[model samples]
Target: MSSSAHSDVAPIVVSDVVKRFDKVTALDHVSLSVLRGETFGLIGPNGSGKTTLIRMLLGLGRPTSGNISVLGRKMPSRQVASRIGYMTQSSALYNELSIRENLAFFGTLYGLRGRRLKERIAATLSLVELAARADSPIQTLSGGMRQRVSLGCALIHEPELIFLDEPTVGIDPELRLAFWEYFAQLNQRGVTLVVSTHHLDEAARCNRLGLLRFGRLLAADSPDALRARSGQQDFEQAFLYFAQQAETAEAGEPTPAAEKEA
Candidate 1:
């Protein structure tokens, strides 16, 4: 496809993807498409395969079965690596380095250099609200501060797509709100974000959400749509409704809602 046409396609497409490690299934027949310039949330509890799916999307791992296309390229495509950003659940930063140094280092890995690198570092620091602490060593920063720096590093290269695995985990509510604000700005700038988060409240901020459970996607739609479908105004209650429906289907019983449609 031509570059322009490719840009018009969905940034992420996972088709019947299954990931396994020996007998353990991390992902099971999952499929979803993430639209361009939208924040797509993977909403599920821990061990629900959010991280596994993100890894596959980032080309760090391949599905045992089925396929994944990122930025119009197949799984594990090096050609699209530079165009994607990933903020891991764990700390991937150098504790000994200053925040500025960490951003510069990661930016260099993305082929940023000299003047451009310096500019990005400055811009990212301000974006994450860490400009004042840019000279502080990572080890000396608080957990929330460190998280901000990690986000800066991920965004230093200004990628078209980004995958954040539980980016707000362990942070204060105030900082979490700040992070989401930064994410909103990114979306406004046409960056596609795939964020895996267990926080149901945070999931509401995304343009759309995929409710995952036991490595299976129960439903993919807007938060309001999910709530409306489940007849629950509460997000948590809505998720439970879907979970129950999935369980019923697995047991070869049709859900009441399904029976009503028949």
Candidate 2:
């Protein structure tokens, strides 16, 4: 084996990963690499295994087969998990805690303390543009602000890699742009980002994208490359084209019920 293959330079890597729930295969021999400081996106229809894949990558859920590595460390290994910051699609914050308190708590849990904890809390809130609202009740913040606060909480320990699952769901277009801007800024600062979202228009912002369906990886490449492969000028059309191709290939296949949103 090549020495670099086992080396830990990049943030996330997976090889032939598979996850199953009884007879249902949530991920089927999936493979991908998230390089250090790059923005990688996972795109797929609902129930196409995006969330399950992220769970496997985060080691929150185990893969039934194959391998996954995060931050140069093999996962499902609890010892290496602290290097990854994960934000689920849902707000995982304590609803009763103020934004500042929430960040403080998570920071402390991540082994931060004293000036370090306070410094991270202050810097992250500012990074997410939520410094002024640090004292606001988590329940009182608007959907967009709440999402930003959730993002800040994730960054409290400044993990070198971040996995964001639909982090922009409730955020408006303007703030969505701002969120990507933050991702760009973070990436520039050497933070690797792995994100999955249903937003096709926003998918263009990613440096690379992987398209999955029925727990299988159909395509993985840049937006431009995927568009070229689909022979479509527009990305939305390109996604639909791939979806149609997948359906046409399956025996008695039904067109994806969620394609309407794509």
Candidate 3:
């Protein structure tokens, strides 16, 4: 396809993807698409395969079956690596290096250099509100500060798509709110974000959410739509309703709502 045509495609497309570890299935025929410039949330409890899916999307792992395309290119493509950012759950910064140094290091890895690299470091620091402590060593910073640095490093390259794995975990409510504000600004600037979180309340913030359970995607839609479909105003209750429906269908039993409709 032409480059412009490729650009018109969805940022992420996963078709019937399955991931396995020996006999254990990490992802089971899960499929979803994330549109350009949208905030897509993967909502599920731990071990629901959110991290596994994110790893595949980042090209760090491969699905045992099916396919995934990221940024109009097949996953594990080096060509798309530089155009994406990933903020892992754990800190990936160097303990001995200063925040500024760490940003420069990650920026260089993304093929940035010279004046441009320096400019990005400054801009990233400002964006994360860590300019005042740019020279502080990673080990000297608190957990919250370290998380901010991690975010800065991920954004240093100004990628078109970003994957955040529980980015707000372990942070204070105020800091979590600040992080969401930053995310909103990124979305306004046309950056696509794929965030995985177990916090049900966070699901409402995304443009769309995929409810995952046991490595399967139960439903993909907007928060209001999911709630309306399940007839539950509470997001958590709606998720439970979908889970029950999936179980009913799997057991060859008509769901309560289906029986009602019939």
Candidate 4:
């Protein structure tokens, strides 16, 4: 491997990234990095700009200011686009097509063809436990099943990096576990994942996490590190603690917890 590849270069880097929507700022000078081969969770409540940031990272939208680099190249660059896979919150599959056909369509879009595409289709279907439903029309599947199909489509190209926006939404506990297991397996094989979610329990499974709120990043660190620094018992409490600290700093006041500690 080249020195750059072996070094501690992060797979995704956002430096002071900002996005605006006319009167409203969707992302406010946010910054974070997703390390190689690790699962990095973006945890926050709804309308926290998690999806907006993901869209910018994927080159779907341009940041009004700041820079973003994915896989060592500047983002929105076609050179590195093929090296990434994105699974959005909404199902993007063709509802009239069979599950297998959806995978084939996406695989082809990623430049896979002929024998390789056929093999990848079979592998991804089995990975998501949808081999039995390969021939079933997408509209026939339940919401969770359709989500799995969407995920399978993202995996069909075997990209080095994966971005999942609320991937486990509407999924049962059992299937959620299965999804995490598959994610772990992919990480072991050198794929990096950036998963955005509101589920604290799921956030705890990540190697590192970025807590976001109101278009800003409150904290970014390992779950245990965050809990320890905030003196909280869980991820949710730690997140709230950090958010409060941010608010206090912005308002030029010492946080209540900081005052108590002093």
Candidate 1 residue-wise lDDT at 145: 91
Model 4 ranges with Cα > 4 A deviation: 1-8, 253-262
TM per candidate = 0.94, 0.90, 0.94, 0.93
| Candidate 3, superposed: residue stretches over 4 Å from native | 5-7, 253-262
User: Is 1 or 2 the stronger prediction by TM-score?
Assistant: 1
Whole-model lDDT, candidate 1?
Answer: 0.88
- Model 4: per-residue Cα lDDT over 194-239, one tens digit each: 9999999998899998888888888888888888999998777888
- Misplaced by over 4 Å in model 2 are 1-9, 247-262
* Model 2: residue 79 alpha-carbon error in angstroms: 2.0
**Model 2: pairs clashing at backbone N, Cα or C within 3 Å:** none
lDDT of 3 by residue, 1-262 (tens): 2265245789899988889999999988888899888899999999999999999999998899999999888887777888899999897899999999999999999999999999999999999999999999999999999999999988999998999999989988888888889999999999999999988988899999998888888899988888999999999999999899888877885532221100
- Candidate with maximal lDDT: 3
Distance from true position, residue 66, model 2, in Å? 1.2
Per-residue lDDT value at 144 in model 2: 87
* Lowest lDDT 10-residue stretch of candidate 1: 253-262
Clashing pairs in 3: none
Q: Write the per-residue lDDT of candidate 1 for residues 78-131, one digit (tens) a residue.
A: 888888899999868999999999998999999999999999999999899888
- Which of the two candidates, 1 or 3, achieves a greater lDDT against the reference? 3
